[model samples]
Target: MISLPLLSHAISSCNGPCRDLNDCDGQLICINGKCNDDPDVGTHICGKNPPPPPSGGRGSGCSQYGTLTCGGSAYPTYKCSPPVTSSTAAKLTNNDFSEGGDGGGPSSCDGKYHSNSERIVALSTGWFANSSRCGKMIKITAKNGRSVMAKVVDECDSMQGCDAEHAYQPPCKNNIVDGSDAVWSALGLDKNVGIVGVTWSMA
Candidate 1:
């Protein structure tokens, strides 16, 4: 496992608001006006410092989990309420990222090749559209309480999706994430579609 060294400054140092990505530390980015750490191999997959619980979802249930608070009030522009903690609220799908008739073939955002052993995810176009999220890390917690940290390796597009301007189609609704076989196994999910309550956050 790879271990990441700590930043000279704590993550909270940059928690203050910022308007530009350049305003935050080189390893951090500005999201929602706050400087935050860019989830990486050390914090997520390396078993070093794990992130907090879900706090950015639907009800107060979200706050009990991660650092970010969830709820309609927490996110003014959010599309839908975040699911309750460990509830089967988020829907999970699967994809092979295979070549040929699989349509888009290899990863559309980055050309990097990810084998099944890698814990990778094909995020919805809405999220994948931001190329900056390409190599970052995301923490995915399943309803069963099994969680895994995965890399943003590819894009998950539905009908009329995966364009340079946009990453998904309207039909993708609710299904914002599609994991590789390795991801499915890591979360203790079955090979088929898994209706899981997922809580994720950047490291």
Candidate 2:
């Protein structure tokens, strides 16, 4: 149930501060504390106000987000995600920071490969804030009531991917906290589940 006045206000104020997705209008979404047009609005699946697909085309895969294909596989893409809060809700995904692993090149913050034994993470593009959060630590809390402190060592890019630098992976969802194995171990999570819901805040 959205109010017309709020929608009008949001439509009139692109880039204005927003508390969440409801504060945005039309195809706009909240990102990094502001409302902006979703870059993948029409292109991605499960997007708000999406236009109809081509008449005879196959449906978009996995009714959650857009997809990018590489090496004969489709990976999800997200141009905008939920706004950040003090205890920001995010998706925690696994990452291997060791050299020759799926993490690809060295970390963006320190240009080094960390061990899976280290508690580290890669934030999404917006929360990474152009490396502003680099080298900092965050507290992650899982649904099972376990928590751990992990360092921010890299960025799970939200804007660009499916290339050599990104290990041919798609752009990350804007609400990702790509954590190392040590972080999962500390939280007593089964990394085999792949992605899980979590809340995080600066530590």
Candidate 3:
């Protein structure tokens, strides 16, 4: 049977914590396993509280503690835990490219592989034309397995060994490297090559 507080017990006050127990009637105030009649019991906890640390999940720890490579070809496992590897990342380069209606020629990029390249400028030609391609991200891999993302720029028109405006001949000149000689020299592509492959996502 359960016990109910009498009319007199209801008016009593509890001065401490209330505990859950057997054989207690109504809201019993239990101070270290004892009950009181003071009404304000177990309400105040005084101290300073601090913000919580980040929870365990993807992308959170990296931002605070800086970036980390767990199972990359270079890092290859952190604390012996295998991370998901990207088996296929898009490749960018132009090699032996012929003139197409898209307006471009072959590039001297013979054996080079590039992925998402970063960019200095926020606005890029590809992205303005196609919002699907928002960022200037590129990744390149060397034969020795060295890979990094390069920045995208307005130099899509600045081909391997050419000027920025295709020597100002025609706006439709398919010669990207015709004016950007210095950049071409940097990439080590000769004028003989006609196509460079740049893989940018549509969105």
Candidate 4:
């Protein structure tokens, strides 16, 4: 958070809105004679915060069912409407990431986007391993004044339209993308296949 200027010398200093002031306006509480309000993170109203209700897709965006690895991260750019056929027609307990994974034994969240250093430093050492990125749930927007909630745990590699089998799941299942479907469906992608600006707050 940046500091706002104060009207230290403005008590009886500058006559009016004369000069010396950069972009101050109105009567906010000026500092050093300048005024300011606050900075906005990124606001967008989407559909639902918990999204499709909590029963569906809670941590899929966290890290592929629940691993906390980059393998589960998704940065969707949803469509203006619902998905198409062969599109994401299923919910959580039935998605790709929901499939059995490696020897991880299933965690509650699948890594979405990450703040690696946060988790890595907290690790004890040889317990499991240190994976970069640590995704947390974030609120985003879609249609109208709706807010969609999604997760971001790991760093994505920018690869779309492909599938990666789970190396340890026997039928080895996990978040494997055949196209942008999973990503698109999960985040309710925008018209363009790109990333959306979501305001994240831990739930």
- The TM-scores, one per candidate, come to 0.48, 0.65, 0.21, 0.21
User: How well is each residue in 1-203 modelled by candidate 4, as lDDT tens digits?
Assistant: 96646545443222233224233321122345434321121112111231232243343322121111133442322211122222222211112222343212222235332221222111111111232223443343333334444443322221111233222222212222111224345445542433333222223
Better of 2 and 4 by lDDT: 2
Question: Runs in model 3 with CA error above 4 Å?
Answer: 1-124, 128-135, 140-148, 155-166, 172-191, 198-203
Q: Which window of ten consecutive residues has the lowest lDDT sum in model 4?
A: 120-129
On the 0 to 100 scale, the lDDT of residue 51 in model 4 is 24
Off by over 4 Å in 1: 1-89, 100-103, 158-171
lDDT of 2 by residue, 1-203 (tens): 85433443354236766767556543346788777765644342223565443343233221233444446655555444455667888999999998988988899999999999999999987788889999998999999999999999999987667667788777787789999999999999999999999999998
Which is better, 1 or 4, measured by TM-score?
1
2 or 4, greater by TM-score: 2
Residue 38 in candidate 1, Cα distance off native in Å = 40
lDDT of 1 by residue, 22-115 (tens): 4553234566867765453112212256455445433433222111112311211112223423323445666565443132457765674556
Global Cα lDDT for candidate 1? 0.52
Candidate 2: where are CA atoms >4 Å away? 1-81
Shift of residue 202 alpha carbon in model 1, Å:
1.0
RMSD score of candidate 3 (Å)? 25.9
lDDT of the candidates, in the order given: 0.52, 0.76, 0.27, 0.27
RMSD, every candidate, angstroms: 14.5, 13.0, 25.9, 19.5
Between candidates 1 and 4, the one scoring higher on lDDT is 1
